[model samples]
Target chain A: MTTAAITVEGLRKRYGDVQAVDGVSLTVERGEFYGILGPNGAGKTTTLEITEGLRRPDEGTVRLLGESPFPRNPELLRRMGVQLQASAFFERLTAREQIRTFASLYGVPAERADAMLETVGLTEKAGTRENKLSGGQAQRLSIACALVHDPELVFLDEPTTGLDPQARRNLWDLLRAINDEGRTVVLTTHYMDEAETLCDRVAVMDHGRVLRVGAPSELVGELGAASLEDVFLQLTGREYRQ
Target chain B: MSAEAFTSLSKAMALGLLRDRTAAFFMLVFPLMFLVLFGALFKNDATARAEIVQVGRVEVFDSLPRDAREGLEEVLEIRRSDDRDEALEEVRAGDVDAVVWQEGDEVRLRYSAADRVRAGNARALVDSVVQQANIAATGQPPAYGLTTRQVEDESLKAIQFLTPGLLGWAVAMGAVFGSAFTLVNWRKKRILRRLWLAPVSAGTVIAARVGVSVALALVQTAVFLGVASVPYYGLELSGDWWLAVPLVVCGTLAFMSIGLVVGAWAKTEEAANGAAQVVILPMAFLSGAFFPLDMAPAWIQTVSGVFPLTYLNEAMQDVLSRGQSWGAALPVMGGLLLFAAVLTAVAARLFRWDDA
Candidate 1:
């Protein structure tokens, strides 16, 4: 099969005199863990939103499995899962009940919800209200809801922002497993260590434009740098904290 | 996909409603609030006695040889006063409900005619006593006849005149305030954004909200209507349960449109609550919530007429209390349609899918 799962050509976006995505273009190989690294407000979320069909670009063409990503085709939405940053649920609903509700939204079978709860390691705490869960548990529940339909492509925006080290490591393992299952995972994160470890390919973005793109080793080696953080700092004209 | 999809939407909305405890409380309170309110209206304050005063010596004053003094004392304290002006001033000041004055052959009753009914009752009691004493002593009927009258030109109460307004007030609140804040809460919680990303349409969202609100408004109407029909309010419900349908629908559309406008406009729960109340209280009070608008200022009436609740009250009164048919509420129907249309447009224009 042809390798690329998503193809973007000459993507551009502007917000009231500020260009958020400037002639950005890229391609993601099928079953690859594609990580986009950027600073805060570097238009990472904007680009992801456009790709997810939440926003339309001023100019460009996007092909997701060879179809437009939006008027938000139902067939396509069913195949792609999204995890928005700082997302939440009603406090009164249990984790199991919420997952079931989201499953219903996709017209999926009830057993799928149970399987997702099991997959996310929340089967024991499934009966607990989402608000009562620890941060890690809630994040796991969010992931469960997003993946209940077994989507092939996942968009995770800062999947580990509020996560502790243990939770983040748990999530990284989950992502690795998902990638191993021949799924395409597109994610954005500011954590350099996360980018170096989890990503199969990296796109270093600054000021809403990708300044560089390569394998982790290629990006690091091009700068004659010891770490991905130095390569990011050298290329983006900014420093990475820690 | 359509049938199964509809069921999924229905289930989601039901779950959403159940998830919000405050929404549940407001939903329940809409009906019960008016129940107690209308119950209090029909409650009898008549058990309390009214105060009045009797005065003057009558035409039979001379004939009551033995018992006239006692007869006068029994009707009132019978304070002896020479000044008619002073006694009339006290009556006008509302020191007592009414007063009486006696001339040589005719007895004159003096009190503010606005409260002339109390004056008439006091006059009757005094006349009967004086006439009994006359028959006992002179064995003759008094020459001047007794008459009864009232002090105030108007008599209004909470039940009959106000229940109609209360019914409208409750329905209006259910529609506008309920609708707006529900949307605001959904948006605030990012539920709308989540919903937008789903397969649901904007039209479906609006329709679902309408369905939920109409169901809520129905419960409120039933409770309020049942309480209002109790004998205390003198609600004379007739043979036409079918007649209320149009009013309920109109009220649902009118208020919910106001709500949609509010929900579309407000960014936060607090802003929505405040905006809804600002519209609600004036519509409740100024649109004859507690009393009739007939005696209120002409300008006030004219201004109140511009509110949808005013038309709602008039329509419901025509149907539930007065037993008029749906055809009779054409004025309300026309006004509500206009109000609903404009408010809906404004709200739709202002509706923001994002937090910004």
Candidate 2:
């Protein structure tokens, strides 16, 4: 059988008084575009971090490409790309230099790093320092760095949260192209439209639990709701925010 | 693959440090400024007067001519002591430059070798006093003469000693501040988490950071030495001066470990900076980076022994100024290594990848 890109089961995590991710489970098949949709404080980022092996789960098993992600399996790490919610770069480095540095970490060629920058439409801004880049431009550079090594699976957290409508649409196109290249793409966001537009399936999370899981349209149809927001409202017996 | 990661990370960090104007200034120009300022201030000043203590009544000194006695007193601050043992202890402890006494016709002068220049001066002044007394007694060359002995070597100057002490402080400040600020800023900006996502281990990242710090420390040493060695400053390097390279490396590691502890414990850039300053500033003063510890109180000298910078400064001075051999620096290097090992353990225990 072909292994799923990611498989997480019975995930549980707690931070002091808050249960950040309680009994969460999900799977993403190879080459699938997946989303974990939630509002603020929904534990989407925490769950993603655990799955990416950046954090250890209080209780759970996460297998990426048929290997455990925790304990830092280098084989899995080599095949996965992750972009954190916060954009980070080496200080005083220009865009080209930044991506090239990341590429070198994975033993990728500088030419490939430059190509990835171009693919993200940041070629013209390659010479600009990271601090000087616009929000959209910086985000694009971050994604370019993540994909420079061509990992088989990619994880992005809140990639479009602060962009303008124009920048957001442009990023959506770039993400779609990445998925179309047959890489398994997993993302977390609060935007209902973004989930409906990009993900083949999405897990709706609220207050540290997965409330429901399906394609956006399938979820809406199952509940006989007008939209994914209404579906969330009906599932939680409350109005959906964000 | 791991090696590649380490090399790339080190290069990137080095570039980042060089490009940050403030960091570059602290690492190079700040120390050089201290060297130039202090060198200029002491350039033309007369040598300090020697302080001597008389163990007992020396009949020869008592019989010196009135003019000769007054002249010798001008160059020597001599105090009389009844207990010969206590006077000898003071000389050994550097409380006094020399201790003088008389046995029959023999005038004896004993001086501490710790401050060779002062000891040499004290011996010369006391010998002149004895010669004048002999002439007054017989009006011809006397049968007995002044006997002088040195506790150690006699080849040091104030500037020669000052160079190593100041250089040690400069290297220490650069390593501590550089590592602490880099680690805290990286965590605040989420760069630590980003590196965590990569395939390399955290050890590799830290090793790369340490590599860059040591490289910068060596650069600081070269700059300080180059500036001080200028003919105008007249810094004379000893044969074993190259031993300072290993000593500098060990000292840098020890100080960098302190920075790591501060960085790992602080959650904000301000906290890290404050914590580093709290640790480094006092060490600079207590380690005798600005003044000789021999002149400090005994209690302060004992307290200074606890700081690794003390060992480093002492060893650097021994090799760079006092012309001591490698044997003098071995024990200090071992102490610094032990210090580095202990602090590294503490830092590892406190390390965090992110604020969360």
Candidate 3:
């Protein structure tokens, strides 16, 4: 049997006549760290959102671990974790309490909150309100909250977008450990370095379609480029800020 | 904690709100300031007869009908045969501050340059006396008819009338502020995204917020009403709060749901706050939180009924002042429920988790 964690075939969506996801298809193998790389408005988020069951695509089909991925089925939601591109929190709540509250939503024990806090190295700061946290600390707390239930699959969207270099490194390490534990992770990122280093396979998207999908080395090898950046530039043809 | 409890996400939300100090301060402390201020402002504890001259009482200056003015106890007016000469004599005698008489529709009034207070008092006294005369001539009281009699209900005190109003104000304020600020902040920070992606449903979030806001609002209502009605501190009840508290909670949910709608639809917390204030200010002012609704214009009464606050204010007045039951407040309470329903529907439809 095929062990693909996610399967998307011709997944499509439109927002007021803008074809946000145009005939895009890809497969993510189980236990693999997959990446979707694109710039703003490139449809990376829209594509990933459909896969996470947050949005219903106008056309196409999506299967997450052999189940249809829409309506956010409770069974699917229970086993999946997601860190949104912009993960807002209740500023008044202490980090630990916030995690505990979310855990209670899934009927997970409150003590699981403590374990996740420690994993994110925030046990010392667990009692602090989110508003009082330093930028890096707050982001880490958000990640801990998403991982509180220890789900089998996780989605990290622009996970390192606004983090400082040091915090970004800390996150990279944490992600590596999570992947090492054999959980499937699908992420979208603006940074090519982030994709190459953390991802096992990468899908570079442009204009609502996946232009290339392959192991990082194989994509570079095919382009005869020194790195993924060169391959990305060669494929997209516009080598500017985006 | 038991499965037998009705505790839902709403219970959790309420608990979370109670844990917040800022929410507590806005919900409880801010309104208490108004309570003390209005209480002191409205204090005629000394039987002081104070009157201010408002507009529209000037139409009766020249012609004084004998009957309406005949029964009145206090009428301060200036009688003069000459203009400048009469004005000079009045200024020296200090009997009345101003002289107002009409030559047709062009009513002329002159004031003493000496004392500002005396001038205003003199103006008000003239206005009232002339109004009384005008009414007497017509042989009618007012357009809608005026019925004036002493309320021998020795229990009707200023504080008694205000306590329930304060209770309603407190509950409504707390619920509205808490729900609005919390939802807006969550959207701004993207924390709502986590809930949208989690095993929890959006309904759970809405339920929790409503629960928390309603509970806190009810508590605030109880605290104020209890303090007022206690025998030692002046038992402010028409009866006990059994009927009042629940209706107040319903009103709280209604207002809180409106706040949530503002928060959910706004692009940011600041916008939500701004929108909430637009609604809250009118409710606070026009709903008779600071003064009696009877003091407002008739048109204001018409406008106020369109808001849940108008109903809540009316309900509080009935329960605490008139010692009425919840049945007396069904219309107003029903208005709040209607507002809550409409706001809930709109909020759910417009709520967005991501920046999109």
The candidates' DockQ values read 0.40, 0.61, 0.30
- Model 1 docking grade: acceptable
- Most accurate candidate by DockQ: 2
> Regarding lDDT, does 1 or 2 come out ahead?
2
Docking class of 3: acceptable
Off by over 4 Å in 1: A1-3, A88-92, A239-242, B1-27, B45-158, B230-234, B330-338
Candidate with maximal lDDT = 2
Name the DockQ score for candidate 1.
Answer: 0.40
Worst 10 residues of 2 chain B by lDDT: B149-158
Q: Write the per-residue lDDT of candidate 1 for residues B1-356, one digit (tens) a residue.
A: 34444555555556666667777666566546765765585566432222443355554543455665564555444454666777778888977655556666566666566666666656676667565755666766667776775432222234544556766676777678667876887777666766666665667667766777777667766767677667655455544544566677777888898888888888887888899899888878888765678899999999898888877777776665555775767767777878788889988899887784
Please give the ranking of all candidate structures by lDDT, highest first, separated by commas: 2, 1, 3
What is the Å distance of residue B312 in model 3 from its true position? 1.7
Error at B34, model 2, angstroms: 0.4
* Stretch of 10 with least lDDT, candidate 1 chain A: A233-242
Task: Report per-prediction Cα RMSD to one decimal.
Answer: 6.0, 8.5, 8.7
DockQ of 3: 0.30
